[model samples]
Target: AGVDDGSRLRLRGEGEAGPPGSQPGDLYIFIRVAPDEIFQRQEYDVYCRLNLSFSQAALGADIEVPLLNNESKIIKVKAATQSGEMMRITGAGIPHVRGNGRGDQIIQMMVETPKKLNKKQKAIFQELAEIEGNPIKETLKGFFQKLKR
Candidate 1:
């Protein structure tokens, strides 16, 4: 009989062959990695949201924030001089690939006021309101005049 070289050849006269002349071939396998939620695989950068307190936003403070490895870290954030300011914490984002550099952490400043003010607080605010003297209207008028020119 003509048998190909790649095919298995059985010899009836083979000695010490598992009692009845049996054979086994080698096996091969491949594996793949699954996506992870905690770790984001990216080339460039990663972003996340960070909340701040009223006092924290008013006066710059160092506060602890949560990270991936269940560890807390204190990141110093500069206080917002004006309302609606954003603070960026550099190189505090997700891990990067081997060749590329790491990402950054963006912390947005949100001024949160108290729901109910105490009597002393209200009185202080009233005094401040009286002292400010409608600066917003004057500022807007100046801005519009500058825009016209």
Candidate 2:
């Protein structure tokens, strides 16, 4: 039977056999779930952190997330989804040993800003900033121009 961490897996009649015809004592195994790189576990629930690019988060996307079963789940990321936001996929977590259903898959989002921008990329972003009518965009433009001086 599947067991959770710190829980004992019982082996009935597999222990020291009692006197002939008598029931044997039980054997127990301590279950320790090793740490994994992709998933964090709590009981049967599973959690993961996913990174999205600035445009992906802002424009929305369907991301393919790896699963424990070697499968992938497509998560629908809503437009304007912010960093650190969470999306829960029902019945996408670890399967319960005794229960009929599984836990939910919790996705923690991280919006990634580009660390380097090419000239064309910078211009595109500047245009986007202007389109957004953000005052900081103008300030940023002046800052970049000042760097050229």
Candidate 3:
């Protein structure tokens, strides 16, 4: 039931029949697979992107990812996981159409920063920024000054 796109199949005697005593023609079928919403197929491999919150990326957590077979699996995200980091689920991808084994699922992590923070959250971030010395702001300021000069 999981035939890949652009696959071809032939059924003998399934097409239009010849004259009364002649044999029927062979029917050829070309397969075309529809695009999935969550997963993308590359050969036998599957890939998808999972979004993580800032805290989740900074701190480790167990996350659920959907499978191609309508099931979900838990993945352990390591602490300080950065954006664009990839995690692999072995044997969780598309199966080889003509072989016996399956491919792997490659998940790319995307860390999403908070767009709006409450007062308490802002205060905490402010404290953290001060503790970290807010180097990013200074770096950008210095770059802009250099450009102006």
Candidate 4:
């Protein structure tokens, strides 16, 4: 018997009829692919966020990032690049249909800053300020001078 789109039934002696009495019908099976959380399926590409530390963003480091398959991959990025810069990971996207070719992985860079600073860390920052010539006071003085002008 022919496969029905919704109906479920068996027609005897109607499909591949054999020996004038015995016959076999066609059996259909449906399969579905699960959606991945880490990979977003776009028109022809995938995009995801890759978080980096402040130091990592400043000093450029090779970070170990996670792929959609729950595997770790190393990707190198420029340390001085701006946030939201895209890094393409070749051949790391969803499988293509009709041989159109697989998609690419787009990684959006995100910089994470430190939340808290300890006393020693603050002292170090103050020392850096002194070394940098403490431009804050000079900047304010310049502003007042411009107003007077």
Error of 4 at 11 (Å): 18
Clashing pairs in 3: none
Q: What is the C-alpha local distance difference test score of candidate 1?
A: 0.56
Q: For residues 1-149, write the lDDT of model 2, one tens digit per residue.
A: 23566877789878888998899999888888787898888777788999999999999999999877889988899999999999988888888888698887799999999999999988888888778886333477788999999
* Cα lDDT, all candidates: 0.56, 0.85, 0.89, 0.71
Candidate number that wins on TM-score, 2 or 3: 3
What's the true lDDT of residue 59 in model 1? 76
Question: Which 10 successive residues of model 3 have the least lDDT summed?
Answer: 133-142
Ranking by lDDT: 3, 2, 4, 1
Per-residue alpha-carbon lDDT of candidate 1 for residues 1-149, written as tens digits (9 for 90 to 100)? 11222344344434343534565433333333354444333333333445666667767788776554477678776766344565555666655545455566554445667789899977766677678874323576788999998
lDDT of model 2 at residue 37?
95
TM-score of 1: 0.48
lDDT string, candidate 4, 1-149, tens digits:
11213435544545654565656655444433455666665755778888887668878998887776678798887869667889998877766655756667899998876688799976766677789888334677788999998
Global CA lDDT computed for model 4: 0.71
Q: After superposition, how far is residue 61 of candidate 4 from its true place, in Å?
A: 0.6
Q: After TM-score superposition, what is the CA distance of residue 72 in candidate 1 from its true location, in Å?
A: 3.1
Q: List ranges where model 4 is wrong by over 4 Å.
A: 1-37, 126-149
Evaluated with TM-score, which candidate comes out highest? Answer: 3
